[model samples]
Target: MRFFCIALAAASCAFADGVGIAFPQENALLPAVKRTYVIGAIPAADATQPLTIAGVTNDVYKTGAFIAMVPVEGGTNTITLTWGTNTLDRTFRVAFPSPPKPAATNTPPRDVRKDLGIPPDEEVSDARPKGKRIEDLTVMIDPGHGGQDTGALMPHGAGEKTVNLLQAQAIEAEFAKYGIKTVMTRTTDDEFPALYARPRRAYAEKVDAFISVHHNSTAADRDPREVRHTAAYASTPNGLALAKAIQQYVGPQVTGVKNAGAQMRSYAVCRNPAVASCLLEIDFINLPEGEDAALNDADRRSRIAHAVLIGFLDWLFAPDDGT
Candidate 1:
């Protein structure tokens, strides 16, 4: 039996022959909840034998991808996967969240803003040459997670992958109104483009900007009802600017959710150095309200799509700090 342990987010492990777990990295600290998902793949050569996790036989797609929601409890949880003669074991820790302390009634409201040392903006001059027109610019839209990788599955609604594609299509349609050209990484449900390849396609197509759409999911221990927000992420300064712009426009348009703000994270899709790239977590799909809006509310999705386009335009036209 091969054993591995990891704790960082988005970590994955594979054996020498390419069979391995792709998510929930080994030695992860999870919420004290009843169940969590395990995503992995096995070699096509071993297709004749069944792939079992914790003794439960899972149906592996032709692409070898498989995802299973498995039972987990508080304390140390060990997950074992068996494919033919190969056995892999991953360990995780589940802990309940500590209760929040009561707030003091006498305490005053706090100012949330802090100094980010951003330079003052310069006024645009009519003499300055006009930049490229919106119609001349091109954007690449990537719908995250597809095929056997279902992303975060909602209890009462469509999976994250499905909603991601839907929102991407809506965004594409909204962009069309402005004559802005848009290229999609995948337009169908069955397409599962490689994570790294998504950005490469953007670079090859010479897109001015890249946006990856996705829904967020919390650990099992957290109450989905209490969590509702939209977040954006990027790895570079330019990417951060784009992310912040998206957060500004997309957050408020989603009626019930709060703006969680932009963050710096090195996601694979957001690492495109050729152009500004951002990954948008439009909403927490695990929540019923969030899922409902994403899966059922057509107007809400269109509003979000328009907001995102506006955010992109705002960022593109903003005066540069000359960093």
Candidate 2:
């Protein structure tokens, strides 16, 4: 059968006959694997026959959705899809897994400190409040997703919910070093707190700050490799200040990832008017590199938690403009 070639970068190309591929966007770089699934749809009006990819037949639903597993090699691979009399081709690259490099020390770049106006010799105690005792300060920590609400999942089965809890616990441990008390929404993976309840808990505790820890994920249509970064979001003035502090301190700790900067977003867990709240999107966990550095690396996770603690401390010590 003659096949019409679609550009590698195109997520879907509509033809006169109404056949399209919906996922594994064009020129996408995927983890090195022997097989991968291709998902797409044919117009229901034209779905007269079963769809096949790489010679494997896939059952098309009544709505025309079809998914089929196809074999791929270490380099560029092509997938051929056939339905009825139409044929289409999609090409993507499967990146070979790189050899593990020697672990590097998790040190924040000197420029990061300088940019934040912190001297190299400064200690956390130096930023302590003047009249207020550190022991009296309290903060609320909300790990983003839990239980069945697994925020994002990698191909190998690691869930973002587990990573969020781990990072939150690490941050809590760091905060403890300064005598700061932290209240977590839920300490275990089995507990799933409602989104609205997270901010309510922060307000009820009268905490000095609220931080919701989370990892990011790219949309199915986007290239995961192009969207790895650190971001923070806030809804109110106080939240903005807290988010900016996080962006300044935690941004550089992720090493190669770019800091996408603090943005204004009214996320459910960060909109508490009574408490300074910020949601930290540590990195895009959908990317393999991001998954390894942000989720799997224990030392890197601890360093990120320490950076977050430092950022919160800095925010607490800044002069209040009475917002």
Pull out the clashing pairs in model 1.
Answer: 6-26
Tens-digit lDDT string for candidate 2 (148-199)? 8988754334567888998999999989987899999989987899877787
- How do the residues 180-290 of candidate 1 rate in per-residue lDDT, one tens digit apiece? 999999999888998877876776676788999999887655555466688899977778888887788887645458888898997878766566789999887654356
**All models: lDDT?**
0.73, 0.71
Error of 2 at 276 (Å): 0.4
- For model 1 the TM-score comes to 0.62
RMSD after CA superposition, every candidate: 12.9, 16.2
Task: Write down the TM-score of every candidate.
Answer: 0.62, 0.61
Q: Could you tell me the lDDT of residue 162 within candidate 2? A: 82
Residue-level lDDT for 206 in candidate 2: 64
